[model samples]
Target: MINKKNILLAAVIFPAVMAFGQQYGGMWIPTELNEKEMKAMGMKISAKQIFDPAKPSIKDAVVQFDGGCTAEIISPKGLLLTNHHCGYDNIQSHSTVENDLLANGFWAKNMGEELPNPGVTVDFVLDIKDVTGQILGNTKNLDAKQAEQVIKNNIDVVSKSFKTEPHQKVIIRPMYYGNKYYAYIIETFKDIRMVGAPPSSIGKFGSDTDNWVFPRHTGDFMMFRIYADKNNKPAEYSKDNVPYKPKHFLPVSIKDKKEGDFTFVFGFPGRTTEYLPSIAVEKIRTEIDPAMIDVRDVALKTLDEKMRADQATKIKYASKYASVANYWKKWKGEVEGLTKSDAVGKKQHYEQSLIAKNPEVKTTLDEFNRLYTEQSPYALSRAYYSEVIRNAETLSLANNFYNFANAAESGKMDAKTLENFKNRLTEIYKNYDPELDAKVTAKVLALYANRVQPQFLPSGFEQYKDVNRNLQTIEELSKNSVITGRGTLNGATMYSGIDKVFEDQNSLVQNLKNDPLMKLFTSMRESYLTKTDGKYAEYQKQIDVLQKKYMAQQMETDKNRTFYPDANSTLRVTYGEVKGSNPKDALYYGYQTHLSGVMEKYVPGDYEFDVPKKLIDLYNKKDYGIYKNSTGDVPVNFTATNHTTGGNSGSPALDANGNLIGLNFDRQWEGTMSDINFDPRFSRNIMVDTKYILFIVDKYADAKWLLNEMKIVK
Candidate 1:
């Protein structure tokens, strides 16, 4: 609930033109774009051309890829383009030792050869509407809990009452800390199929070493196609389904790009916390990021060693390693970037000015500082629990068993629930290695025991303080635990006869309860549930309330300041220019990289820098075809000033004329902190030049059928 003081401060933040002097940055909603400013920055298309619900527009082509990343339609036949990593899981699912699609890429010669993905979906934004007033209309006097329920009820009613087709879903998301709300009418197509993907040597080139670094030569793009029913609407995957006909698809542009050429990213950018107070930012930089990084560092080291030694292990853990390493490295860079950029100092200075302008803001800032100080330890404990349980795969599996056992005891385990559990267990064991997990668990648990405060440590975890003894205990558990199914201990294993074991719920629950790994997981889970979680949630709610008020206060205090809601996984338009950066003193990065750079970094038989033989041959022969740029070298990757974050992966980077020129992938290491503190000096989004994608399909893979479908503009 909001008080009278805050209520008075709360006004409609969404004006037609919110920004004034700032030329770049901001993830603007499609409906409220700054047309004049975009034109001034070299945009040749009108706002209507970018997004028109009634007609074909650029927005019609872009979609939310499988809910986590972005993708766009590239042809009239619904050919989709996204990052290789975005499709990594599907590719990995189809790979085996005999035919490793990841090591040697996959290309479909014709439509009939395309591989269907069971659960993949591409969502289109049919329309967006402001639903703030209706959502918050009756909750001014209620407390936080009561108001939350009322808001939820309102959202349910509003969504159900909205006029939409049966295929469309209405999602309402709050912005500016619940100050505003927007409803998105989404049409999700579930029948998506993989068309082509380059090998890891091309798609994931430079892997960990160059993940967030500039001068990156990674191709990082994958191709898929959407399918629809006879009516050309969303449907389940069926043999009768046909390639979808899209209303709009991007025109592939091979025109030469110059520095400062207007570029904009259109995608569903993920979460960002750009409005946190100085105290919060300082805590994250100093305490939170380092703690999580430490946990992942141990897990990645153990996994990387095993992966390099065995090909089977490599295939199993490739996706897992990439997932862990992506954020582990990003956090390292985020800490550095926050420190280098002096984000806390700048935020503190701004806070002082804000308080000076309007003294009433002092209360809100003081509350923030106090809450953060009180909440730091609890927050750290929560982070440790989450990271430790996640990285220790055996313990994670045990936790799942614990949950299932509890459900069985509680009479909630129906046949479908049991079946789902079995399926999940099978999927996990498909990639599970008990010995490898044991090694990782020993190191991570030891770190957790030593680092977490005694008060926050789970009861059984205290024994883990003895590192050698802890290692021995985990070794024994991995060998005999029912969760791992490695060694027989009363004939209870996860592999076979799961249904027979579950026939007697009491016996199953008792067995799981007695398992050593499950006992360890229960101790940790119970301790957190009893000691830390409640307090953490309490402090977070208080912080969220104050933060919302603080946001309004800042807007009211600085009337001239432009405001945009922080990203919450919604379609946004972030425009900038093709530009380079000087991240540090005397350190400059160019806007683009070429095939020559890839060759220079190539190392034969190396995991990260290996180049495919066909690619090398093409490079030696200079066979770049029409995809070669004006410099007579094919561009591999490039950097731009468009503000982006995690979910922007696979977003479309459009040129001035709204042509697809690049596929947004990674961000420069120095810019990973842009989610919290965006400093234009160091923040740049990395992209794959569209020309490189075409070159790989045409010259390297010889998939001319794909190029024939695209509308390539020379």
Candidate 2:
């Protein structure tokens, strides 16, 4: 049940908050507990009900074969379902034009057709225990610092006790900040393999352009299977490895369901920020988002220019370009939201109003704003330097860790791991675009040098220069690529290493503590007053006073309303009717699209949204097969406005009654801002019409057994 008032506050009040309406909860109903609501609309069972090991619907039928994304046991013999891009690296590693599994969808007519993916594994969540008692069981009145450490210690102790063996993995995550903690005991299977994936042409048709946007026509989905040893335990792959057994696969029904059908999504949704000071909001809008947009735009433009001039360069940069361009588009959207929306003014007003109500909160508001104002610019500069220009610094640090580890610790690297790391270096360095990397690195550092403080510098780099525009001189210093590139790539090892990182000798860290360049970067970041310990203290005080007031008034004004805490990556439920919205009277994003619209995106030469020949051939064959939706052809589109964020990809979108109706792959770009502003009009969940997926499987792949496995109903 939702609190009517809070829902109104989320859906209407607070313009910025309402704008990002769908980012609040998750993709689907997790348990059969949600089944009653699901059935009212002619659906089956909640994803939670289907996948929860404790639930009855598919409890025994579901298996948690670990993958980056979740997978479900869908067959009497273990079969798994997951997204294709999650398996991209593995599939790409084994593919060539002749047998490009990505370009042409892989179909295993039988278990023998499945291919092995080394180092890939599936994890099954075996047990989850709510340990709120164990954590807050004592010391309810401890100071924040003491509480933090105590929580850590308590979690460690409980985690150790819960572990059945060394092979199982243990995780204890706190929920609602300090309110609760959950321990998840997992059994990880290391030897998982790729069953099949459609070519990017079809599987990822819209590519970046259609990535977060809609009228979005993209297949953006895929499938895989997990394997195990005959003992039904996790195992490494070998010629002898065989198909995993016993689990439930989703059943399909082509029965026509009309618009406004109830829908939901269930998958491991990663993270969100429904709780933040409007102060943070203003800062993000004013300084952070814009600066990032500009920096990424510059790099992407440079890369695109070079890639366009040379075919070989383009191929080499396909992945890089795709990544850069995709995010650049996102940032640009963010920038637009910042400028066009009332994020800044609204945040300011909200903070001010909060402070006005409680004199006790004035100090906290003042301190927060004081720090936020100071740090905003500096924080923005460091972000550009760290993320865009000095991007190599991260890899440098990683390499340094490896180096220090092997150098300081004896027997740190096994032969295979060492070989693997060496191979990684060889590959990275060989194709590494030194010129582009250096150019970006130099500019970023220049920004830091000019904008930040020298006091922050390490004594070494500091003695040579002051924090000023003179950082351009460092670019000249970079001319010795033999010097800069070598130092950044190889010399980083002197400071970084696996064993060394874990070791307590902060000697290298201290030595570089005064490194002028690093200090300069640090100084730039120090500008943000938001992180000041004193400021946070004051802010906490004010919040304490204000929360007491706000809570009382909120209770009186919105009586009998359900108000859950902001999403803490814990389980939660949100309910809404399925309806399309008119963002503006003149424009409306219909909650559905068809296969023919996908065909319309086809162009002969462009790679971005080009349709694959085989899929086109399959479509032209006029064979709807099992993939046809109510319209009698593959259904390619559906919609939902459930709140979602980064981690929600691949969640199963269930209709009312908890039946699997669609797979949530993306949010419409118009709604990409859904994270910050969910305009139900444009913010809708993008799903790969289940019927279309079934068509790809049955008509295209001919996996009749897969169809037989699930209890499909309409």
Candidate 3:
């Protein structure tokens, strides 16, 4: 029996109370904004001013930078701003041992000197239309796969119907776990060039030690420019390409930010599971994350030791090492945060309330609990596969070669596929160290064999269950397998030999089948596909269905409460205020950090905390150059309550008047868990203040011409 009156009362009152209590957690869609809430929170601009499709609005200024991060146009000439880490790969690609731009820094005095980057792109959202009605019509009786097909087919049809210009594309992404959908018309620019970046001492100041921690003074911003054809249309890289004239661009603000100043971030957020059930959270905290964390810990420890021993190895593996360590550290923080917050208990309590309000949904809640329990083992097995087999660089490469050999043996390899595969191998081996990967592979395999259940463990791993034996076995396999490229003549030519081996498909296949490493990978992959992957898929599909139902029910029962769709790598807006964090009883962090703090952390010749000589000289001369705050210190970075995630890197942090005040790069340490559960008390997005960016460009880099191109407001 369900009481409609009580349900209605809870819907209205609970939402209002929650909205009042939780001020800054949700990543809201621009279309379904809560204007009243925005106004109450010191928003000086209207909703239309933030996102208007008919005319240029704040949304037009933000674009997806290099696919994985966000950037904002700062000048009509398409001068783009993003996090230095976001542009790190492009900068590294252009660097060499002789002239390492990442080490010494690079500044383009003029537009002609800007370095062109191949394959870097930016996507601007032209429009976003809700197509749920069109996509979900006539789908009541279809199975999940059939319904999925219908949605995909409909999206294709709808995408084609949109009148888009050349180089423009349409993307339809499902939100709220397929409960709702929106089609985005996007314009992608292919000709992107790097303009300026500070030395690692400044850009990556306090590197790993200060990363994800507050009281930070990192200048983590990078500058680039988007170029278009003569007709101002998107085009591939060409010498003739000119700076793109954007519809709108953000004006940099140098005004000092006080505590509690209104702030908002607009960008493409990657993912968030804030709506997941308690059982799933418990599974992640108890089983999945720990296994992944342990595997990465072993891999990182091995890499770190090798990297410290040799400069060449350090340069080669720096980016890969950082990528692994970043998430490795974050996962640990997430588990700790979840446990400390008692997230499972809170979710269970919330669910109980939901059950009480709607007794009819009690069956659904039980099913959720049961399905999660049943799926935990398979999920853990899959996590092991992801962490060990799939992530080990050499094993992954060997698997790639195995696939290529199969394709050739089956007569399915064409010139295009073969050429693509060869090019991929070239890139893979460029920075790859076979010895390092071999060491990592041994540890990963041993971990999997020891931790995973006997029946769930990948086949053939049982033979090498002993850790020392596993290491010896992999070392021996590394010597035998031509794929590893160890002890091979002209190691440069070794990867190229992949093409020669492909000439004799049957022989290559037989060789790979006999290779110990390949054989091991095959056994593990077979066990995964047969015993783990299939069950995981079935359980995942069922879970997704129930989750969607749960989401729909929540929306229906709480119309008065604003139910924001979970982030699915779509453009979203999250607003809050300039704030600090009190992670512990006595550890309170200030919102703003300054150049003085950078000097305090500086150590001569230190990789992470070194200060540039020119910056030191400027500080000694007290050349604040109009960029310093009233306290006469140049502001380096700050923190805010704006909800952000991985993809939100390089997002523009706007003030109440919609001026670009900071560049969102990282989040506070405790706030890393905000991706799963945003607690305003601790969650704060770290940003590089705009004033610091301008100061570095003008005074430090002496790129006054670059500064002149922007609309800088005091």
Evaluate all candidate structures by whole-model CA lDDT and list the values in order: 0.89, 0.56, 0.85
Model 1 agreement with the true structure over 1-714: per-residue lDDT tens digits: 113453343223322222341222588899988787788778999999999989999999999999999999999999999999999999998899999999999999999999999999999998899999999999998988899999999999999988888778999999888888999999999999999999999999999788899989999999999999999988999999999999999999989899979999999999999889999999999999999999999899999899989998997887678778888999999999999989999899989999889999888888888999999999999988899999999888888888888788788999899889988888888888899999899889998999999899776567787667877889998887777777443455666665565667787678777888888888889999888999999999999988888988887898766677899999999988788888877788999899999999999998889999999999999998898888899998998888899899999999999999999999999878989987766889999999999999999999999999999999
lDDT of the structure predicted as candidate 2: 0.56
Candidate 2's TM-score reads: 0.77
lDDT score, candidate 2, position 169? 81
lDDT of 2 by residue, 399-425 (tens): 344353545456555656655755565
Lowest lDDT block of 10, candidate 3: 15-24
Ranking by TM-score: 3, 1, 2
Q: Estimate the TM-score of every prediction.
A: 0.92, 0.77, 0.92
Could you tell me how far off, in angstroms, the CA of residue 330 lies in candidate 1 after the best superposition?
1.2
Whole-model lDDT, model 3: 0.85
